[model samples]
Target: MTRSAAIVLLLLSGCTLQRPVPSEPDATPMRIVSMNPCVDTILMEIADSKQIAAISHYSQDPRASSVPLKWAMQYPVVSGAAEDVIAASPDLVIAGPHVSIQTIAALKRLGIPLMQVSVPETVDESKKQISDIAARIGHRQTGANLNAKIDTAIAAAQSGAPPVSALIWQGSGLVPGKGTLADELMTRTGFRNLSSMLGLKKWDILPIEGLLSQPPAVLLAGQANMGAGNADSNRMLSHPVLRNIGARIKIAHYPSSLLHCGGPIIIKSVARLAEIRRLMEAKP
Candidate 1:
């Protein structure tokens, strides 16, 4: 064969010799499983529904869910059980700070891609968690958008008024002191956290007597109506004394739902807080 004939033969048979066009990358969605309720709320905000195989069953529970129950019920739920996760056959599993060690070990043993997140104690930390989770699922821009919403809300709620002494009285007089997202949020909304002022730690129980001894200017009552029929849950919040001493304090209902997670909920939480603060200012 002549050189021209050989060249044509090679062109026809040796396609690999031509600068191979890089094939388009696989477009398969990353099948993600979330074993934590907090992360579930974040995923619901940043990831596509098709990407999520299952979210933590806790997100389905109204008492524990950070997101609205109606919205959360639309997704499948897993119990954070190894068997449940394996059955989902997730391409990646995201666990929260409280995920069990055994489950982590099992996932590692099975050679599954896994990522874990911690409870964000500050606003910056919460945003970072959102960014990391979105990046893992290839939704970085969505995460950034959500973060921007948080910043806008924060700016809008940024209070220039003087800080009024306030206490976040959750069910059974449970209080979140300094070093918590709640504490930081209170400051952001222009309220002095009375829990920290009383020398409380990160989380502590504030007795009724303690509250009465040095009542704050505002009371941000949380979870007051969670278990309506349960006396145990209603005891402190429903006490007659609180009603009688009402005029001395600015009482507002800050629900337990808003206290749980920080992602999208922070926007609502901050707005509510600012509204409450404005109410206090409107009053004497």
Candidate 2:
């Protein structure tokens, strides 16, 4: 072939090589790590089976998560340490606001994209937090649906109830006060939380004697303290002073995950309390 023709062919080959090759878009996180139980539940609810890499150990507890134990068993559980998280090398990581600040800082330094979730102290705040997490994970629709469910449950719970007072017992004689999720749940479930009237904030350790003397008509106990064979519940139930309260007393169990950390599960917690309230009202 002529030299000119050969040069033209070479140029044609070079041009063809320079043309861009069409490629598929990147996948949306095939591996995810959740450092908090709240985030773990949210992720598991929406993430594809192949996408979840690991979750916090707390997700294994049925009381703490909606995920079944069998499902939780399929994934590795991280204890919220930098080493464990780094080893997972997940495409996404979720951490709670209460998670160790130092661990978060370390993960950030390592250039991991960490999503921070806040613990809601009120029902309104819980809704906002759930929405934020859902939006972050591209599940805004799911969040909206869940929010509607929560609203309906709360409304039903509040219907047809007289002015009833309630106290929430966390543990070790601690009661949650005003501006807290516990208070909000109690209020939404058709009862007034006496803690707010007394102007308490956060969880306060109350004297057992004082509580017995002026106990509310209904008492809500934390799930941790109400679990079967719980010594704390046994002691409280067996207390002589507690048994003598004139007002009707009922033990309502609050999910520790919802009350302790605050998340989407709070809606379920409200529903549970509402059921308890219905049962209490039925007693003649």
Candidate 3:
């Protein structure tokens, strides 16, 4: 039997001891496949358990997943290949913005429908995306419930504390600037992004030299606890100049996981930001 046929046979046979979600079905279920990690998160929130045929393989990796790996592992995974998608037998496939032209054409040729979602730069955009994706999945009320959760998070994260100047430092000298989701999160958590003073754009590099001069009251390092193997990033973090600023800047962990993608994740991201902001407030 061919590889695809063999896999189909495996599904057809009674060997489902290892796979979490089996691939056999009659023709009545709504099997939705998510090819993006962020999309995987949103789908988990709005779609019924039986509606999810497969999720992105990325969600299976704790290092890259936006959702909890323990939760995501309960579903099947596909690595964004047309063949893999076909094996899942999806009625609709939702993908991230970076889908290749070839993959799109292949899906089209195979008669599988595709929906692509882009990264939202702000919280409002993220809310709209959640509702829209939920609507498309035929669970409009569930989508509204998710959006209500975001609204609650936003309200709870509202801070009366003064806007302390801060910079969200990610690995390799990259920083989030105005109009990005990180920036909005910081704003809501009582942080005023210092990247604006350095004339940075939406997403730009803020070198160590710039850090020495334009220090903020708080430095939220995205890779502070991780990415130790990145030699160049390590050198930047361990720079002699950065060592001397402890008395002036409050360096704290702002995990790289929160840097990209927003869905149900916005709640956690905003909460962390507020926690750090409150820490800063408690100090002189």
Candidate 4:
């Protein structure tokens, strides 16, 4: 072959051998399954609807789910069953640190990629969790924006009003004490956690006599209404004595979902507490 002809032929062959440009990088998870409700909520916020294979069954329950039930119902749910997860054929399976060991072992045995996210105990930890998950799913910018919103809400809540004495009272007089997310949130939102004032530690139940002796400025009920027509369950919160005492104190409702998990709900919870603070300050 002539030199020029040979050169041209070689160039053509090189072109033929060149690989076509790949389509956009698969940033989204092809098939995602979440075994934890908290992970399900995070995935819903960051992942595309089509990318989700299945979500935790707890997300389908209105009382326990952080995400809206209507939105959760749009996706299929799994009960953390290894067979169900394997059958879903998910490329990435997200779970909490506390998921069943058998399920984790089964997924590992099958060589499925499993990501375990732990429950964040503070606002900073919660933000880190969001960033970590978002990066894992190739949504770093989304995670940054979410963290920004959380920070703004926190600042607004802290600056809303002066601190008031507040007790996070739940069913059976249970109180979240120092070192808990609720305690930190309450302090940040301009409230002195009565749990600490009353010498209650983490996860302690307050005695009725002790609480009556030292009343708080605000009684933040974990449930909006604990009146389920059950006398035993309602005795502490609904008793006429407690109701009479509540008349002199600020009573507010704090949802159970906001307190259980840390994520986008922190924004709403902080904002709500700020509003309550403003209202309390406005009161004569």
Best by lDDT: 1
- In candidate 2, stretches whose alpha carbon ends up further than 4 angstroms from where it belongs are 1-27, 61-67, 222-234, 244-248, 253-258
TM-score of each: 0.86, 0.78, 0.84, 0.83
Error of 4 at 216 (Å): 1.1
Give me the overall lDDT of model 4.
0.76
By TM-score, the candidates rank as 1, 3, 4, 2
Candidate 4 residue pairs in clash (backbone atoms < 3 Å)? none
Alpha carbon lDDT of residue 65, candidate 1? 75
Give each model's whole-structure lDDT: 0.80, 0.67, 0.78, 0.76
- Write the residue-wise lDDT of candidate 3 on 241-275 in tens digits: 77777898887877777778788889888888888
lDDT (tens digit, per residue) of candidate 4 on 1-284: 85435434544454432322222234456778888888877777777788898999988986568899999998888886665776677778888987777678766755677778887879999999999888877789988988998999998888545689988777678788888888888889888898877888888988678788789888877543565632123246656777777677777876667676777878988987888788788888
User: For model 1, how does the per-residue alpha-carbon lDDT over 1-284 read when each residue is reduced to its tens digit?
Assistant: 95435434544464333222221233333678889888888888899888888889988876577877887888778885666776676778889878777667766755677788888999999999999888778888999999999999999998898998999887777899999998899999999998866878899989898999899998887635555543224357677898899889767878877776888889988999999989888985
Q: What is the lDDT of residue 22 in candidate 3?
A: 27
Error of 1 at 35 (Å): 1.3
- C-alpha RMSD values across all candidates: 13.6, 13.2, 6.0, 13.7
Per-residue CA lDDT of model 2 for 66-160, tens digit only, reads 55678789999888666677678766677877677666765665556667777678777877877876676567787777777778877777847
Question: CA lDDT of 194 in candidate 4?
Answer: 80
TM-score of 3: 0.84
Worst 10 residues of 1 by lDDT: 18-27
